[model samples]
Target: MVFILDTVMCIVTTMPQTKVPLSKRERTARRLTLCLMTEEKQRRPRPSVPYGPTAKTVAEGVQKMRKRRQLTIYELSALLKKAGRPITPSAIAKIERGERRVDVDDLMALTTALGVSPAALLLPLKDSPHQSIEITGAGEVPADVAWEWASNERSLPLSSGDASEAELGYQLHSLPPGRRYLRSRPVGRAVEALRRDVDRVVEISQRSQSRHPSEFADRLAAARLSLGRLEAELARMEAEREEFDRSSREELERLRQEAARLVEEQSRGGGDDGAGVD
Candidate 1:
């Protein structure tokens, strides 16, 4: 059952110019949240395949590569030509459109031209299940929208790494465990991933608290409260799924009983006619 969110998924359009300075992990989380929130809230149609988060993430990646390289489409075309691949500006546009998939060599060319590491181009533009899509946004980017985009951004990534896994712990800070007033689904992959990250963070917090019990007590309490919030959301989603499953089962049972009754009535009528024949 594919349900369309009539509401537009417009969360993070223009990145914030200035906000709190974030650690590397926090920045990833903030970006993820901002991106995913947009996806969730902004469901507007786009002229691209892999529409929705996948398309948006790819477009964003292309844009990022171009920006990092400090090159316009024309410049990128020139660079590629000089490099011997001879990619056209039209082709660059097509790649950005998510119509054409670029190879690692293409990625390297863009990265080198942009003067950034290949890793920079490959930073999980899409928030994946493996990495936390922690994003932060202000300036009227609705919280619901931000959550959706950040949470689903991971589903958009076309590409991964040990480094990606290592950053997972820090990346989780910006994500919402559940949407406002709605419990995340029991099998909700996003919710489950959040839980896994929480568990890891909680372990770290516990060790820290143990080593400096008095100093970290306040922080530990705060973490516990957050866990409570997430658990509540998860519990609610679980209940909804259970209720839906029960209703489905009941409907099946009713149909079965109706069929059985019809069969019995036919058998009885057949017996009555047989008696007359005998």
Candidate 2:
């Protein structure tokens, strides 16, 4: 059946159309070829959708970075090729013109060629620190906020209020351990800074009490109130950290066990196959 179809296709395609009267077999072959071509066209994947805002940002960044580095489109293409992810200069041009969508592989190659982070390409240029960026699903956010979120410095807050540790943990859970540490570092430093401020205020209050007993009452009361609020915040942060740690350990163990199970199953399957062969 396949050979017959191939022969029909070859005759129908290679034979030139002529004004001569057609034979019955020739007409049948032509119909079969037309049907097969239509089916093949239907089976082919559709072209990608138009580039979105994020893709436009990457395109702009690629062009901007390339120019800043004193590279032409061809030079940038050469660099990408050297990095083992070659994009033709014409395709790079289309990408810069927002006529081509930059996929993940292209984005990585562009980042390497442009000597910038993927976040740098993904985020729009910071014309002003206060400029608002329209991130899909997240709506509009400040440029600095967008950069921070993209860089994994902090999680993007989708809600109206401040993002809680649970949200942060959720974001960090999928990240590797090194990235999780980096992402959580800024918050940890802020907590430590607040603790130091509370400590300093308490030490000052104690010294004041020793020197001027009368003034110490109001000062001590204010310090106590402030300290109480800060202490509550500190405790909440501590609890959240512990919770994040516990969840991370559990996830890691689960992944490890899943991997081991797969390995064991593959080994057993291999042994059975070998026995069957013998």
State each candidate's clash count.
Answer: 25, 0
* Candidate 2 C-alpha lDDT tens digits along 217-270: 654565566566656767887999999999999999999999999999999999
| Ten-residue stretch with the least lDDT total in model 1 | 1-10
Off by over 4 Å in 2: 1-48, 127-129, 160-162, 174-187, 191-278
lDDT of 1 at 142: 31
Off by over 4 Å in 1: 1-222
Model 1 lDDT on a 0 to 1 scale: 0.58
CA lDDT, every prediction?
A: 0.58, 0.75
TM-score of each: 0.30, 0.49
Best by lDDT: 2
Q: Tell me, what's the RMSD of every candidate?
A: 25.5, 22.4
In terms of TM-score, which candidate is strongest?
Answer: 2
